[model samples]
Target: MKKSGMSLLEIVISISIAVVIFIPAMNMFSTTGQAVFKTRNFSFANSAARRISQRLMAMPYEDIVEVPLPGIALFDAPAESFFAPFLNTSGTNSGAKNITQADMPEFYSYLVQHDFRYSLSVSNVSFGDGDEIKSVGILITWSENNKNMMYRLYVYVPSL
Candidate 1:
């Protein structure tokens, strides 16, 4: 009687084929996943840079130039949402909405918790044409394993 079953050689061949196909497919999936993760991180960094740049541009100009406390960097000041209204031209909640050195950590902490590392640099450039440009540069850096990423945004406020 003829046995109705796959031969041992046939079974082995089938399994081998499956492993060959599955190995490459699984590798492809993992690679795609890593690329997606990196893209997402990059997008987040870009957004954070944009957010801070917009905040600087929306300032009343005067506040942007107001020197920070001695020994403190300008960008490092107004490091909290509490100081938003103060930097802008309008709005009043209650009491003085000031940003202290203590608030700096809160801002950095917020970004770090959100998976972003942020740093900002501001400069005032006056051209010979009598045009003054206030440039605010925001840099956001983050890393995963051996992969490193950064985003820089430059916002210029021309003399109005």
Candidate 2:
């Protein structure tokens, strides 16, 4: 008698091969998805840093001085530890100076809407141009896949 259908052994072998191929394909897809997410997050953080840097560059050269204004605070308190030195806390107000969302409502709102936190600081830097140049640094932080990620940007502004 000729068998018109696959034997049980053949059927089992085919199923096993399919499962082996499927598992690795599924894993590859998962890894690709994770990589895509990380790239997107990095792009977003970089953009935010650039935006803050542009704002700093737009300010008058003298305004880059570290001033102690009361209402300017960091978006995240923890960031203060890493950015204290660059902070400009020596200008006018002396009442608990901090950089808060209120300082730039538009920036703050955009960050909040995207679940990001940022810190901006300015410091004196001599770029072979005496004391006429200032350095501005912006740090943009966000969480991705339970990991903390940060993007940093630095810009030099001249007294022009």
* Candidate with maximal lDDT: 2
In order of appearance, the predictions have TM-scores of 0.59, 0.57
Each prediction's total of clashing residue pairs, residues at least 3 apart in sequence or on different chains, is: 0, 13
Off by over 4 Å in 1: 1-8, 60-115, 127-131
Q: For each candidate in the order shown, give its overall lDDT on alpha carbons.
A: 0.60, 0.62
By summed lDDT, which 10 consecutive residues of candidate 2 come out lowest?
A: 67-76
The global Cα lDDT (0 to 1) of model 2 is 0.62
Residue-by-residue lDDT tens digits, candidate 2, 33-68: 989877877886787567556667776676554433
Question: How well does model 1 score by local distance difference test?
Answer: 0.60
How would you encode candidate 1's per-residue C-alpha lDDT over 7-96 as one tens digit per residue? 999999999999999999999999999898777777866765676667777766645553221213222344453223234433544443
